[model samples]
Target chain A: MIEFIPSAFAATFSVSVLLALAAGTFAGIIIGALPGLGTVLGLVMALPFTYVMDPATAIALLLSIYVSSIYGGSISAILINVPGTPQSAASVFDGYPMAQRGDGALALGYATVGSFIGGIFSLIVLVLIAPQLAKFALQFGPIETFALIVFALTTIAWVSSGEMLKGLLSATIGLFLALIGPDAMTGQIRFNFDSLFLSAGLTVIPLLIGFFAVSEILYQAAVLKDVKLPAVTSGGFKLAPWSEWKPRIMVILRSCGIGSFIGVLPGTGATAAVFVSYADAKRRSPNPEDFGKGEPSGLLASEASNNAVSGGAMVPMMALGIPGDGGTVVLMGALTIHNVIPGVRLFSQQPDLVTLIFVLLFLSNILMLFIGGFGANLFSRMLRIPTTLLMPLVFMMSVVGAYAIRSNPVDLFVVVIFGVVGFLLRLNRFPPAPIIIGFVLGAPLEMSLRQGLILTDMNFLAFFASPIALILFCITGLIILNLFGLGNAISKRFRRKETQSNN
Target chain B: MQQKNADMLYGAVLAGMACAMFAHTFSPIYQNEFLFGDVSTVFFPRVLLGIIFVLSMMLVVKGKLSTSDAILTQINVKRVLLTGGATLITVVGVWYLGYLVMMPVGVFLIGLALGYPNLVILGITSLISPLVVWVILAKFAQVSFAPGTLL
Candidate 1:
């Protein structure tokens, strides 16, 4: 790990890689600053472009977008009341008030610096944790692997949305979609129904385009009312004095810790982290009443934590091939397309590539800070482009992307079909991440389970023989029980017993 | 529609899909017994569909007891249908006319359908955007595009 750093630094400083980094960061900021166009859609739109590039350059581009988009959301949140992404929702509370009082530049500055610190802080944590985690995961056998996947899927589905039942159903549907192709073990066609396309199975890139990009276009069409552009009051950056930031150092650091830790958990993402950090900052401040009234601490907490999540979320995906949230899910898809399969094997076989990813992430975050500050005015102007014109371009890109993957006309239909399906699912409050993640993990889940079963002579009880598998199964059971409100029921029973004992 | 009724309908559709999937397990392909283990190709799918069916029914029951409105409180049906219809046409057009010719017209109509008032900007964007994307994807990336017989 220590030796890889110099090599990583050399690779990251090359011409093409730097160009990709700069372009990706610039585009990411604009995308993040625009209301309604978000990080997921931006990543989806960029997916087609990566089809031709090398793995390192492609990853650099996507990582830049992922990191900067979160910070870019704060720009719109400060300049206008609208948050560029859901992750920036907490920024509006104090950011807008600051802008309203003619300190928009200062607010933007705090966000930029806080985001930088948080991003760097999370990268350090990732560097320290991911290699060790991957090393530990090398001990997992087939049964343990299968069990871990089950636990990950269950936990993601259960926590990803408000309605646990719907999330589970969505995951089940994804698993069913995966089973549509040929069976990996026996090479027998199960659900093809004699269609050649079904036998060939669905590819990951087209599925991601359909699920995220096409679905977004349909959703915007369904809900978009009038194109009323918000008034941009300020358009540049201004640094606050050291005295102003000196007192809030602890707040920023604590928020980074909260954000990175929460981001490491499956399914929570940056949205929850930002709010939790914001509330923590507010609670700890002596002048708590100033929280929603242009307090620098509030803005710092929101911006810092959300940006920190970018690094935190990548840890699990790199080490275990399990995405922590939606953005990382897309990143995982991009990695798969580039033939950089992220898992324990990735670490063992291709340590250099892993280091390159770590290096790219660090570079992307540092680049995001400079680009975000230097190009604030230009990104602010990007908000003026009507969603009308922007969306048509998005649709065109979606078409080209879906077709570019395999040059198959049939894939276009797949996009439309899944687009409609995704929109319908969204209407019913079903979280889409579980479906995407489930689809990603589906083959491995089936392969490992069958392999473990065959090795153990088809005795299902033998799956529990491994200590790791037993622990994973226990965790999965606990998650399911909590999802069904069983935890609450037992806690209530205990409370009642305690009341009786006190009497 | 009320959210509860919509949820019930959604649940019913999911249950119907589950039933269809469950029926597929009886087919010849899935019925083949495995040599290595008792678990067949259909075992995982059948289990998944069963779980989906059960949860979907639970959703129906819960929807029946609750008084919540649909998740989307307000939807512009006309716009959604128009946008969806226009997109379908674009796909079909791309099939018949190819990407170079069909994309410009498709984009223009979609923008129009989505209420872009300025035809000048919309028309220019529609025409130029496709060309730029084609050049990047086709020229630089070396991706192939279907040249329709008409084109």
Candidate 2:
């Protein structure tokens, strides 16, 4: 792994790769700085172009977008009261106040430096841990693998946006959708209704375009009755004095740790991490009341933790093939498009590629710090691009992406149908992430379960024979219990801790 | 018109769809009874459908208990329907007409339907975007486009 660092750099430093990084990161920041657009939307829009690029170039492009977008969101949070992304919601607590007090430049400085530190720290953790985690995952058998997928599926409840049952229903719908084509076990078609296109099964590209792109267009069109945001003037970076920052170093480090840990939990996204880190920072700060009041520590906690989550969220996706959140789910899809299936198999089959991904991620963050610092004002101007104009361009991209996948006219209908359904689902608070999770994991879960069942001679309880499987089952059971009421009890305890911290 | 109790309506629709899907999974078209696998093809789907059915019922109950958010808040339904109709026309246009002829027109119509006030910008963009995409993806990258029979 140490030796490959140089080789990884070699692969990543090529003209094409660097160009991709520059383009993706720049566009990502602009998208993130815009109020309505976000990291996920940026990623979804970029997916169309990856159909033509190589694996390394594609990953480089997507990783650049993923890392920089979190940082970009803070720019808006500081310059204006709005958080460009959900991950930046905590940043608004202090970021806006700093801006309100005419210290917006200083706030941006803290966020930039803090984000840089958080990104690098998480990368270090990723480099140290991902290979080992993947190695451990390779030891799992069919039953254990199935149990792990079940655990991963249960994580849908975590990022369900406060609607767990609706999330489960969406996942179930995804499973049903995945079952539409021919049976993998047997070569028989199931739910095609005699259509040639359905017989081939729903392609990932069209489904994603529908779910993320076209649906977003419809939703925005429906809901955007008026545009009301005022343009903000971005100021240059201004760091706090050393003595002022000395006390907050521990807050930054601890928040990174918190961010990384929470990010590794599937479906517990950066939004959650920022909140947890903010609460933790407030708890430890000597001047707790300074939080949400232009406090440097508050900005550091939010920016550091959210940026840290970019690396941490990739852990499970890279090591175990389970997406930790919506963004990684799309990345996983991108990998599949490039013929790089992300799992334990990826590490063994293509270690060089994996190393290159790590190297690219590191470079992306380093570039983000400089590019983001230099381009802050330019990114702020992105907010002026109206949704009216932006939505139309995105629609064009979606059409091309869907059509380019198979050049089938029927796929356009697929995009439209799913787009409509996805819009309705969003309105009902059934989050889209769970549906993608269910779709991505559907085949593996079914295959593993069926194989395990065959191996156990149809005895269901025999799946628990493996210690790994047993442990996973126990964890799943506990999660179910938590879903009922235990989670609320735990959250109440945390709330009490937060209240004490505020005092 | 205002959509009152949108959550309850959504729940009821979801339950109906789930029931329909559940029933469909049992249809003769999906049967794999003679297969030798431990689980039939229908087995997993049936389980998923059943879960969806139960969850939708739960959603209905939840919808009844809780006040619904503004799922349809100030949304111009007429605009939505028109845009949807325009999208359908775009798909059909691309199917019946070739990419070169239909794509720009489709894009322009879509932009117009979405209430873009500047027809000049919408028309210019509609024309330019498809051509640019075609040149980049189809011309440069060797991606094939759907050339309708009319072409």
Best by TM-score: 1
Tell me the alpha-carbon RMSD of every candidate.
1.6, 3.8
Q: Best by lDDT, which number?
A: 1
Model 2 lDDT per residue over A247-296, tens place: 88999999999988888888898999999999999999888999989888
Score candidate 2 by TM-score against the native: 0.92
Model 2, runs deviating above 4 Å: A482-503, B1-7, B29-37, B65-74, B98-103, B106-108, B117-124, B146-149
Candidate 2 CAPRI category: medium
Error at A486, model 2, angstroms: 7.6
* DockQ, prediction 2: 0.57
- Residue pairs in clash, model 2: none
lDDT of 2 at A177: 81
